[model samples]
Target chain A: MPEHESPIVTVDIVLLTLEDEQLKVTLMERTKEPFAGRLALPGGYVHTNTDQNGDDAARRIMTTKLGFAPSHMEQLETISGPTRDPRGWSVSIVYVALISREALASHSAIPLHLYPVAALPELAFDHNKIVRRAVERLRSKGTYSTLPCHLLPARFSIPQMHHVFELVLGVPLNRTSFTRKVSEMGILELAGKEPAAGRGRTAAQYRLKEEVSFFHRPLGDGM
Target chain B: MPEHESPIVTVDIVLLTLEDEQLKVTLMERTKEPFAGRLALPGGYVHTNTDQNGDDAARRIMTTKLGFAPSHMEQLETISGPTRDPRGWSVSIVYVALISREALASHSAIPLHLYPVAALPELAFDHNKIVRRAVERLRSKGTYSTLPCHLLPARFSIPQMHHVFELVLGVPLNRTSFTRKVSEMGILELAGKEPAAGRGRTAAQYRLKEEVSFFHRPLGDGM
Candidate 1:
């Protein structure tokens, strides 16, 4: 391949969380051309000198652009084509990250706009497709993995955790069935605490045993 | 990024199939430096002039090197690092492809070697890691999708298909339960045929419905 034909490699991250009972993704305004001033995922070029790989680049971009590390991160997909970027044949190693709403509220230095996954605005450089793919991956994995825990606070009640899963999965889960299935997975342990007063009946708080766990069976019958 | 620092982009394919009741992958002897005379996955540089994207490059490499198109192909992962390729900073868009064993027998012109997934030889570059990731993805997805069909003939009996799944999953499935679960999925149709003489009991032939099916529930219990 000629020098001019070399593809520009970049990493794009779709950071997702549940805010106001809606599944939202973080977007930043691009300051450079090729779609200047448009909303885009937090990303940048793969620094050959300072970064070791795409994962490193993604983490660096997240910390530098968002000012916080995500609780959960995984490579979603690689979007590459001739027309994805106007500059040249570029490839974007896309990733999906999850952060708790409380964490996002505490770290408010970065000027990021949260948009509902269903009602995302016009994004820059085929980012809409990238975000869609990430959402699908998140929901698909949510069925068998304890990925929803990352979208909640460290200690949360069963109802709060169920709400996060329902929002991300776009379905209402029965409270009894949800609690039973989640408890049966053996990934969550009672924190031996309760919510503050005036929050209706005091629901027992639970915390994820570990970061994530893949269940041998699906959490529910189907989404 | 400067022109000299441009990353060398390529596509490496992990083509898997069942051979002698063992899950095997295809590897070729490298004829160039950076692991010459060693076993490596079939790969080539992404043709900026002829190929549109990594998918196109993967298919092109398959047809040229393996002389057949895979029944199923999907992007596995993109491995990029400064030390992965001894030449320079390079990125390889890896993919996983599956073709029936019968197809491999018919198109046996290429000088390729088959190695079982259990016991693999020293592979060139980080191909061992790439192949491992592909196997993980295959097994993970095999639980809910009709992915094993790609590793069998176009038309096969239920028992033959069950055998393929058992070999790939490394578990013996109960015939009664396996048939019931597969039938409940509604992803297979009778081919109105049976195997020729000399085979075991005459079993009804079946083919995968369309190409593939993603079962809402797992086809069977945990492997």
Candidate 2:
């Protein structure tokens, strides 16, 4: 190996969204060599001069390739297998972002072709595995952590919140029971009445009750 | 650069032990180049011929450096910055191991030194940050996940379990309330009472409830 050659470090963003009762991820068609024209998560080679740190690299990838700063970004994992990238032996730091589906659909600046996770076509490199791992982490940690709130609007009804959990966990919850459990957790606050937007019962909206700092505090027993 | 000189991808193991309620990590005195004699996580450059995958790489490092495999190993985030290693730009897939204090204190196969998270000396590379991040992840994720159970024996009293949580969370829990809450969750079952070992009450021994898989489901108010 030449002493002057430097290993390239890249960043991949797994932006997740919920739409039509299914989880979707934003992907882009690669425009250059080494897996060109394949659907892949938006990413690019990180330069030391520009991306001074891990957080900077993540932000740069989101802004430069996706054309917007992500509201929430987290470092997921790093892929370092020799064949993960073809042009050369490249390492990529993977980060995940959670965006409200409504905001993404209404906003015109976000550059992406969203695809449902269930029907994802062949993705560039090992992105499929990356996406799957991220989803699993989100699903497992989302239960006891404050992550689910990162996926919805500032104010939402209790039923809406239940849907988010159901979708991520891939299970149905009894409405009365779920509400009672959530209420006792003290993670939601009543934010006034909902102006009936549907034909069913007018429901009360809720906001995040409080920031839970305890990580291992167990949930309540079922009623 | 020659084709044979591929960038090295390695896996580093951060073996953690709880010593006197302080989180501690195992470090090795490097015997080779770049930073010889400097303390660092046990690791080596990985190749497919030596082991099957990245996880295997982690095991190899532990076996070669510690002379045994960890009882509980997990995939932590990876460290792949270009400048992390001094000799060349190498990527490291980091993994973590959590073991009980008594287990570590009784072990003799591993020839290594353990240092508290605080009062650490200099490390070989950018491992200080990696170790710190692993600790942060362990502490935070330990709350919402069943990870802490990995640090305990197969059966333990509720008070002992609560004390483990308090030690990791850095906060004291109300004994009466914590026991009731844990029992109410129905995620624990009596394993027949064991005679008291110390000055505490005759604590009833319990193991995690069976078929409690639903407890792992994601929970949150809303996005």
Candidate 3:
């Protein structure tokens, strides 16, 4: 196939985080003609000259547009069709990244806005569908992996971790049951620290085990 | 970007099935250059003229190349980079499909070969990596969904179903435990039929319930 006849390939990232107990995704206002002044996920065309792969392009886009690197990133899905982009057929290798809200606070070079995943406004292109897919991936994987930990600091209390899980899953879990399940996963270790001041009794802090990628076993009920 | 300078986009499918209690995948010998006369997954360039999206391209590829349509198909991953394809920068939207051995037996227009997933020979391009990703997706999803049913006929006995799951999961599940788990999922309905001619007493047959997409809850422990 001739180059122009082929679809244009790009990378759009769904950068997710927890803000005030609500799941939010990063969005930016477009400054180009295709969707000038409209809100869209931060993305750009693949730089074949410099990028080694789509993953590289996604990381570069995150750094240059969002001003920080995500601690956890994975290929979410690829959205493509003839009607996705007005210019022509376009294929976007969408990636999902999880980061702490504090990570974004220190790097605010770009004028990006964080909107709750459920209450997102009209976005450019087919980004709304992309964000929905990312959220589904996160919530489903949250049951089996240490995914919610990406939204927390290095060390956190069991109660704090439980709250994060509840927020992502949208279902309140029994306190005793949640803690026991986390303990059984064997992916977390005691950090030898106490919760920060000002909240009732000080709860012992825990951190993810070093070099652990994900839990070897399922964390919760499979669904 | 000029037409000639852009990367080419294509779709490749990892079609999987079970044969003789072993997991097998379909491969075809490439007739064109790049990797002529070598074993590769049945795939081709995206047909922008007719295909509305990658999903359509994948289905078309299956019909034309494999001479059969898969029962289940989903977007697996998009493999992209300058190094993936030898003919310059190319992006392949990989899809995972599940079919039954009987389906392939009925449609034999194309000369395709079935190879065990574990003992695959040197394949053309980066197809080995694509096949590996498909297997991982299948095995992980097998824990929560009725995925192995795609490898069986419409109606089958419990023992036959168990064998299919064992082949895909590579683990022997206790008959009692597996039956209990399947009953709890409520996705299968008794078909009011007896097993086909066999060596022993006739067993009750079951089929997947109509309009069932996936289980509402997880099915079993993660592998």
Candidate 4:
């Protein structure tokens, strides 16, 4: 096969976090051709020489583009088309990384541009579509599973988890029902200490026991 | 970039259907090098000039290898690694297509090899892993949505749908409760005429009302 025979392959990561109760995504300005100086998901070509697989390629891209890679990275989906990139036919193995704003602020080496995923500007290639797909997965999983719990720090209170679910689902949930739903799922464990609230009451704290726990019944039909 | 710089990209499809009351997957023996004469998922190199996208490549591979593509095709996860392929790092965009045995028999131009998903033998590349992933998705979706209805014919009876669910879930469901659960889902519309069962009894007929309907509550926790 000739050089033009294969489709251009790369890895793109959508790093999402919560800041000021708004879901934000990390992006960088491409300094190379095909979208130079334009905002895009932090990504680059797959280094076949050093990358053992897509996971390796994703981690390498994140480490190279950003200073440090987030601990939790998930394989989202692969997007390919003839026109998605200025280069010939291309395939992008996408990943979704979740982190807390506080954690990200401590690790980032470069000046990171964070944008609200709901109000993102025009991005390079089909990145905007990829970001939307990742967000859709998170939102859909928020209904019945503790997937959105990844957006929170390792230790989170039940109320904090409830608020994260509301933020991801983009709707308010009944406090009691939401707490009951989490209790029914049994995916959370009691954390060490309780956090003080405005009323001088200590809120019950919980930590996720699994990466993701799905209960048959949903908290509320978000979609 | 050199020829080897771009990873080889291909499309593989796991065509699954219900046959003899068991979940069977379609595979073909490869006739080319790098695993010639070995059983593998129906797939081939991505035709960049012709294929519009991954969907096109999957459809093309199915049509060329299996004579016809299934009516319902899902974009399963993509698999990639350097050691998985002998030549170089490769990316395979995998798909899972569901069709009834009756429909498949009518469309296949050549002899097809059908194997039970649970008893799969060694296959070329990482096809077994891909098959398991597809089955896992089906099983997970089976617990909460009308996804398994796709494995049946377009219009089927309630008992027929129940049997298909049992096959996918590998569990016998209570007859009355299963019917009630599906009815609550509101995913099935009356398919007009009833099918006569044994002993002068008639079974109610129903057809899927949506591509996929999620009722929040699952039929049962299959996983």
Candidate 5:
């Protein structure tokens, strides 16, 4: 392909967070064509002159568009095609970013627009397809990893973690097994104690040992 | 970026298969400038006009370069940088493909130059780093999924599947436990009995119901 017809390459990020027990993705109105003024994932053309690589492009986009970095980010898949972007053939190295509600709230002044994953407005380009793949990755990884933990506060009680799993997996887990399984993974450490809940009962708070962890066993079994 | 400064975009594939119980990756002698005589992963510039998407580009390359299509292929990740290719900025959608030794033997006329992954030559560009990530993914997925089974013949004995896991994960697993776990996953069906071993006892051959299946539990616990 000639220089003028070089595949229009870019990077797009699906920044996801849980708001009031509902999973949401941040979107912004496109500031330029091919869909100016329409909602789309935060993204831009790769700065071949400045950006070192795809990861750098993702970090730069997050900083410039979202105002805050996600605690957890991963390359979900690269979305490419002739029709994805109206400007000739284009490619987007799509990524998924996870922010806890607490983390998201800390930057509330940015006025980020979030829409539920289950019910998204028709987004610009192939963004809706990109978001679905991101969710699929989240759900698939959630079955055996502490990935959803990124959806909770930096410090959270056991029940808070349990509730997030149920919300994301759409299945109720027995509380005792959930606690034991998480404990066995050894990905969490006791951080402190939560202020008393109803009935004046205090719950223990914990912090993840890492950004994410995959369990030896899927949470679906024996839960 | 100006038309003349457009980034060079391409796709590279890391085609891996097992040979004599050893993990090997396919490479071809580079036929172009920058690394004309060096062996590198089979790759080419993406046909922006003819290829519809990344997957399509991958397929076209497989057919044109290898002549035989792989039974298992996936988008591992996209690698990009200014210096990866001598020709300006470039992006390559790296893919990993798995082929059974049996399948590869059938296409012996292709004269493929496969190198053991454990001991690789100095590959062109960042191809070595790309190979390392592909191996990492294969190892991680081997722990919980029947991914390594792709290294076996389409119809294989139970012990053949178990040995491939051991080779890929670099861990020995108890036979009874491996059998029980695989049975529970329900991803394989008995195809036929293998020719009798030295003891004059035939072993059952099984065919994977799908290309791969993840077990609810890792093959790490219990005998």
Candidate 6:
């Protein structure tokens, strides 16, 4: 058998963010054939020399295709189908990312549609299924994981962070309880002064403790 | 560009079972190149003619590649990388399946190795990552989903079922509580009289209630 007969696999990034409190995924219109001119996730053939590891592959895809860096990019799942590609048999590793709305507010070259997960139109390849799985991961695992932070800025207030959780989980949380629970985690530290906004006393700003490891906790154990 | 120039995606199945109280994943020694003669998970390329809907691709891949009929299979994730396949840029949809030890034991000449996931050697492409993810899924979400049933025979006792849970989760479950929780789920029905064994009263034989939708429940929320 010749060397050209082997199979190939690649990675695709599904960069998601909560813009205006709605779940949105970044998509790019195709510039090549097969699914050319159609809207799809911003990804291409996985380059060998791009990044050192799997997380870097996602970062590279996001940077090259979307022109922005994601705060957190995670391996969500993989999608493979014999006929998914018109060329031949190919498999793809799909990674889902979360970031703040302001991160990509100015990227216009790639032309992205921040569509809600529920109202997303038919996408190229098996990405629709991929997107659904990402949504499920976000909704279910978001409770316990540091995923909530992915939707907020690096330096933000408790109320702003709480709003992100409400948007993603589709559940309302008591403000007092949420504040107490988050503070006890010791994952955040006060940034000094409070934000000047509507309230009896302005809320304090916080920055995530850099050395803390959030992956050790069991999924959905507590939120 | 010609239609043949496009890339394709495929799905692979990691049919897992418990044999002699040990966890095992189904693998085949490849007769072709690209990790030829090495033990790899049973899979095949995806094509338009295999299934009308993308969701059915997993079922088709199992039947075509391994020559077995599985009752169910769920999409785990997708993997894609330029170097993962030497042929071209391809992606694969990986699915993890669970079946009873009795089913695998009763079947013969399936051309598979029941390898333990923990001691697995370097596999073809990114298969090691795929297997690891599948095992993590089983360990975490196995309780909430109908995963245990997938590892049980058509009719089995509560004790037999609990044994499987123990093997997969690596935890001992209280017999009384396990049975009580399972009964409350209303997802398993008494198939008939239990198998007679030396000792106490014969336990009732039970089978999964096919009507209950197990996927919709929250993960880590059930027994």
Top TM-score hit: 5
List TM-score (chain A only) for every prediction.
Answer: 0.87, 0.84, 0.89, 0.88, 0.89, 0.82
Those runs of model 1 whose alpha carbons end farther than 4 Å from true positions after fitting are: A1-4, A195-201, A211-223, B1-4, B107-111, B193-201, B211-223
- Better TM-score candidate (2, 3): 3
Q: Candidate 2 docking category?
A: incorrect
Per-prediction TM-score of chain B?
A: 0.87, 0.81, 0.88, 0.89, 0.89, 0.84
How much is the lDDT of residue B98 in candidate 2?
A: 81
10 residues in a row with least lDDT, candidate 3 chain B: B214-223
**How many residue-pair clashes does candidate 5 contain?**
0
Query: For candidate 6 chain A, which ten residues in a row score worst on lDDT?
Result: A214-223
Instruction: Output the lDDT of residue A101, model 6.
Output: 73
Q: Which is the winner by DockQ between candidate 3 and candidate 4?
A: 4
* lDDT for each candidate structure: 0.79, 0.70, 0.79, 0.81, 0.80, 0.69
Clashing pairs in 1: none
lDDT of 2 by residue, A1-223 (tens): 2233334567788888888888899999988766789999988765554444455667777777767766677777666544666655556778888877876765537556889987889999888888887898788666665666667777899889989988877888788988887887788888888768777748798888556422211111120
Candidate 1's iRMSD: 8.6
lDDT of 6 by residue, B91-166 (tens): 5667777777676656533565788887888788677777877888788776655676778788988888888888
lDDT for each residue of candidate 1 in B84-164, tens digit (9 for 90 to 100): 889778889888888787888887577668899789988999888788777877887776667777898878888898899
As for DockQ, the candidate ahead, 1 or 2, is: 1
Choose 4 or 6, whichever is better by TM-score. Answer: 4
Model 3 ranges with Cα > 4 A deviation = A2-4, A107-111, A195-201, A211-223, B1-4, B107-111, B195-201, B214-223
Model 4 docking grade: acceptable
**Tens digit per residue, CA lDDT, model 6, A58-85:** 6677777777666556676554445666
TM-score of 2: 0.75
Q: Indicate the residue-level lDDT of B71 in model 6.
A: 59
lDDT of 5 by residue, A1-223 (tens): 4433678888999988999779999999987777888899999888888977787888788888878666467777777778877788888888787878778889655889989999998899978877877887788777678778888888988888999988888789899999888988788988998667598778899898863533212112242
DockQ winner between candidates 2 and 4: 4
Off by over 4 Å in 5: A1-4, A198-200, A211-223, B1-4, B198-200, B211-223
Q: Which one is best on DockQ?
A: 4
